[model samples]
Target: MKFGVQYYPEHWPRDRWAVDAKMMQRAGVNVVRMGEFAWSAYEPKEGALDFTWMEEAIALLSSHGIRTILCTCSRTPPPWLYQKHPGIVNCALNGNTQPTDERYRVGLAHGEFIAEAQRIDGAVIRHFAGNKHIVGWQVDNEIGASNDCFCPRCREKFQEHLRQKYSTPGALNEAWGSHFWSYNIEDFSEVPTPHKRAQPLVEYRRFMSGLNVEFSRWRADLIRELDPGKLVTTNYQNIHAQHTDCHALGRTVDVNGMNHYPARTPELAIDYYRGARGEVWCLEQHTRLQHHDTPAGRMRLWAWMAIAHGATGIVYFRWRQCRWGQEQFGDGLLPHSGEENRFYGDLSRIGAEIKHLGDMLAPTRPRAKAAIVFSYESRWSFEASGFDRGLGPVTEAVDFHKALSRRLTAIDAMDPRENLSAYRLVIAPRLWMVDQRIADNLRSFVGQGGTLCLTTASGVVDEYSKSFDTPRPGRLQDLAGVTVSDLAFDKALRLPLASDVIPDLDGEEGSLLADEVHPTGATVIATHAAGWRKGSPAITMHTVGKGRVVYVGVRLSPEAVQTLTNWLCETTGFPKPFELPNGVSACERACDDYTLLFFINYRDDPQNVQVGEGWIDAFTGESVAVAEVPANDLRILRSGK
Candidate 1:
């Protein structure tokens, strides 16, 4: 329940430090994250380094009872270092070296660059190793926000990584299935740069993602060695961010952190990052409007939404907007005039509320009965193949997650390889790429009394992006009890569904992609009601050991997805609490002592909810049978001993 803001003492004049600190303290901000982007300010020249200003700033903030989330500036090195090591520039996909004017232009595998980065990072950590005001370390500012380079050195390193992984050239060839276009390699070095091939492109993505993970781990380990008392973390961009695998990167830090923009990003992103690692933080929570105008109270509501999704701390992006740079128009709590506005008023109100809530919400966690599996490999593979451009894996996953949100059930969105034994229901959307390991995991989940639902375009390729010689779903056909004969790709196909099986899904329209599913041992729950493929199986269900599996062969409408999800919840006996009205959402976090419910009204009009007698509002500490929450507002209630 900590509230904070991103601050940059180096960006402003020396005299403004105490002023900003006093203002933030009055606003109830307990923390300030700084220095992840101030490399040039710290070291103006190549061999010249000074940290006196940073120390002075830290001391000033500490006097006001504000801690610091210090950050390593390896992401953006000073200009002198780049000029000294000109070869460290990244090689773009077009084979030209990217200029070093912008940040993140240095190649990850560059030897000289890595040495210098490590030196600077070690020096920075050693300087503040025992500082009491420094509470945590942010490894880097959005590590791998840009794609990695494809230089010869990186290629050589990737080949070495493959050699270390495969042990032999023959194994590498088999794993990548490089024999399709005479691309088979006799030596590990023979693997060419990524082209139009799916396997190589997917492997390159994995390799680049690994480079990011290794880089973050390097800095995190350095921090641990120098400052073991402080926590280390880095913010992930989003779920569809292809530059780095966040789930893999989460392992390098003590806590998972995310840059959240609820106006543009989905609720699934918050839940995904929350589940990626145990405790999460909104490192760069949105304060100002981006792309769209944020309503008066929506900003604070979004902050609470992050907390409801299990974020331990919420740090707004910035205290004031910059008057210069590319993001000059990017708004913050204070406008360019450095005066408070409506947004600052909203922040002040929420800050007081959070102060009142205090540490009472710290021990609770989001107890979820359903989970959605999201795979980066599958998403990368799908994007590489360019089979269906409009059908994104992230879109499908978010759609299902939104449906679950509409039903007032908190979901754990994470990688498919994560543990699925904790939940009663699991949904995997567009799992286009499946390996034997993932297949076994899903099978085990279904076999152990858990209900599993898989959407269209699932299991179309193996681990190496090669189509299975057998059925379409690769190793999941037997477990799913269905095989695909032909895939319908017509965008205009609004095929009707059967009415009797699920009455709510009756006559629902299906579009985009549809598979002609031939069931082997599964029961055909729904079939096409129109066109030439009339009465064909569009959705099927199979009963396994102690669980059940449902295969959705067509992309159904949003209404249909919700209906199917509701039916699945009912069939699985997972509770779907608090039927929310339109434009309203609710999520719950609980412990043995009590359950806290967060009700948010996203609509422009106020909404009312009927609560039981035992429920008490956390903010107001009032017991009531009914609660009226204003538009773009939120309420937290504690119930059940």
Candidate 2:
């Protein structure tokens, strides 16, 4: 595994370079990701490119055994470029042009903007192509972070995209069901930017997602062309960022990278990124609080959490916090004074431990028997439809995942369209947009003996973001063995629900939304205990082939949902290999030769847990049958086969 930090050489003086290099060497830092936001430093003026300073810095770092992961530096274009092409600024959905002063404001769909970005990107790649110390390339710093442009160029491109997708305006109109409001168009160009209409908004969402993928693909291809041997990657933000489809973006890179801020983002964000690819890198890991101080050992704990979820490379966000700029207060391993702090000690300890365990942990990947399926399209479609303001798909998915995480190891939170045959159990929460392909995929997965669990608000829409005329869940009614007869979505309405299959939540009240399910041949596992819709099926189970499908028709309490998730896990016969106490989690990454375990204590109090025999603590190199995990700390262990 690679242990590194993000270093901004341009931010400091030349004399400080060697000092940072020596400090990194002592801390077991092997890599430094640089130049992501340094376009202005590289090209101070138009056509006045300078690579000598960067080359010197790279050479200095290489001398200290620290390699570089150079970034293309196209995301934040220099001020001169923006001044030269002011038209590159993005236009927001409300018809206001975003100022070009902000980072990542270049319109991706703008042809001239692309040409300029490619020019600077190509220059950077060609300049550093032969640099031996550079291991890989980060295409851009979080592609599509601020690239959502609703300008005329984007509208034209969107129209062109729709034309290519439907081949005719009439077909597009029919697919979008635009005739309902007499909104049918005679030409694709007549379609405006995403507005009040559900179909156009969802389609535009998908189109923007595609544009992000295409943008990354272009950069990755350019990198490969310049240096075919080097790996290409781009940093992805939290999973809920709907501008880009991460799974699609991952296909364009050699490896997926993510920015991990445990305080702001959930732990499952790492899993989602890993699921986007197979293994991932923590490209920008928070080492301290923005303004406040991080509790001791918390940074190390978060790093281990990432590794536990299959992070092959862990890079702290920055070596030192910036003294000036927008991120002046964003703390790092070292304080603004460039002095050693608790974060430095924590980082050095983790780095040394990683250096010792790198070989054993490198080959091992996360293997999970169960998965939680997530879809951006489903989320986009549902959000566009404005069914419920509080219905957050990512939050709901995370709730189920957290429940499963208490008992399971390495539960994959991935896209629903990914291969599912390997998983024994799969939970898809709020799968609102179910198309023929999605429906068939779930049917096939369940048919092949995989237990599938789907939650409420599923199967409401088809591929075009249009509601189906048939019963709810659309094409999945037969597979689910139930149809939603009436949806009770009133804020004051709550169902007193009971379940025999999951008896732990019996007599529990469920609210937010409830689908009164009429089971055809399926078994009513749960029903409303007391309500206007009393005795109605709130949860049902159907045995399709060798497998079964469990349908949850209402949003239950977090505790109740957990009980149901645990019931599903038990039903699938998933092995509970690690028996961990509450507030402690054991994540396993195994290879043929050995199994690596990361024990994380999430509470303020110490946690004492018994480890299985033949396990050795990776940090202390001691054989132990019992381990005491400290508060907000982590322990890594390995066992030979």
Candidate 3:
């Protein structure tokens, strides 16, 4: 596997390059990612160039046998570019243009913005195209921003995108339910951003996701045009709120990369990697000591967790801690003094292990028995407009996904094009925006002996932002075998599973969104505990064709959700959980000749697992008489005999 680290050349003096490179080689770090936010230094003027410093840094790293992944530095446009072309500035829904203070303040669709990005990307690739040391290129850094664009250029492009999708103004009006307020439009340009008060969520969400996808395509195209051989990717922050669809973005890139902060649990690191489809590179791994009572081996544990989930590379955000800067990120392998720290020792140990593992930890795609249907459009819609309640289905969906990730072998957030037939169980959590075709597909999956799990606040809206006039569950009501009579927007209630199928389900409160369910032809598995709608079905199951469809009417805690998800996985005959201690994680992938298992011990204390005879530990080149692990360690075990 190739190991790389993200670094800022401008932050460290040129003189320190040799020292840093040497240290990296000693630690077995091979690749270094450079220049994501170096626009100011790269292009000082509108049509000027500066590569003297970057060239030297690249050369110094190459001489040390380290490869480089050059970034286009388009994430933050240079102040000169933004000042010269004010049109590139992103305008929020409130009619406010972003200030120069923030990094991602430029609109993606602005013509000048696209032109400037292309120029910079072309220049960087052309300069280093022949350089053997350059391995890949990162297109941008976290493309999606939270706010909606209300600028005239974005507004126009959004209308055009909508027109191409919906076809006519009348069709658009009908889909968005514009007649509710006698708000009918004659042209596409009449469409407006849904405000906090206005509830035209479906259209707004579709527009936002569409915009992001277009931007991703634009950036990927620019980079590919310059260097086709160099793998191109954009780092994605693993959060639902950012509205960046990594799954959709993954289709545009050669490889997938994600930034993770796994302070919550070691399991979260594994989950994030699985979500990104397992071909991942960690852009940022926190490795510093902080005030919070974070566990002692937390960093090591999370790092190993990532490796187990198919990380071909391991890299930290900062090699040296920052002394004075706006970021001043405290986490680094090396302390601010440029001396070896405790974290550095741990990193070196892990790096040595990876080097020893060598080909054993090569890129191995996951073999998933389950799939999760995640839609960027659905997330966009929920954030755009909805019942103004504190707890909503969107938040619940993200929570449920995190919960499911803890137990599943491979859990992927997938687009519609992905094959669902291979999955024994398919889950669609909080899929609010369900068109007829998608609804039909899910029904077919269940009909064809595949388990289907659908959660609450689903099938509420259509593609056009209009609620289904019939009932709450809308298009999926019949397939779910339940008719949602009315939705209690933000009501709180507790419900427990009647059957002792899974442990610990007593008095778990369901908040955010709840519905009054009236089962049409489904078996009631659970009921609500309070309110006038008490005793109403909260969980229902229906046998469809040779399979089954389970509908959850309310959200549950992470633990409770995991219990249910595990039950489904077990029922479908998925693989057993990997054998590892609490702080240790393991993931396995099998090829034609060999089966590789990634084992990571993420604890301060050493962890020991009894591996059956005939498996060799790839890291230490040791033939294990009995399986055991050391503190803060990672290993890959390959078996071919």
Question: What is candidate 2's lDDT per residue for 206-298, written digit by digit as tens?
Answer: 888898899889889988988889988889977768888988999999998999998888778888889835599899988977767567888
CA RMSD for every model? Answer: 1.6, 1.5, 3.4
Worst 10 residues of 2 by lDDT: 386-395
Candidate 2 runs further than 4 Å off: 388-390
Residue 544 of model 1 has an lDDT of 94
TM-score of 1: 0.97
After superposing candidate 3 on the true structure, give the runs of residues whose Cα lies further than 4 Å from its correct spot: 146-148, 197-202, 264-278, 289-297, 387-408, 500-512, 528-535, 575-586, 596-640
- Candidate 1 per-residue C-alpha lDDT over 89-167 given as tens digits, one digit per residue, 9 for 90 to 100: 8898877998776778888889898899888888899998989999999988888876488888888888888888889
Worst 10 residues of 3 by lDDT: 264-273
Please estimate how well model 1 matches the true structure, expressed as its whole-model Cα lDDT: 0.85
For residue 31, model 2's alpha carbon misses the true position, in angstroms, by: 0.3
TM-score of each candidate?
0.97, 0.97, 0.88
The parts of candidate 1 lying over 4 Å away from their true place are 276-278, 388-390
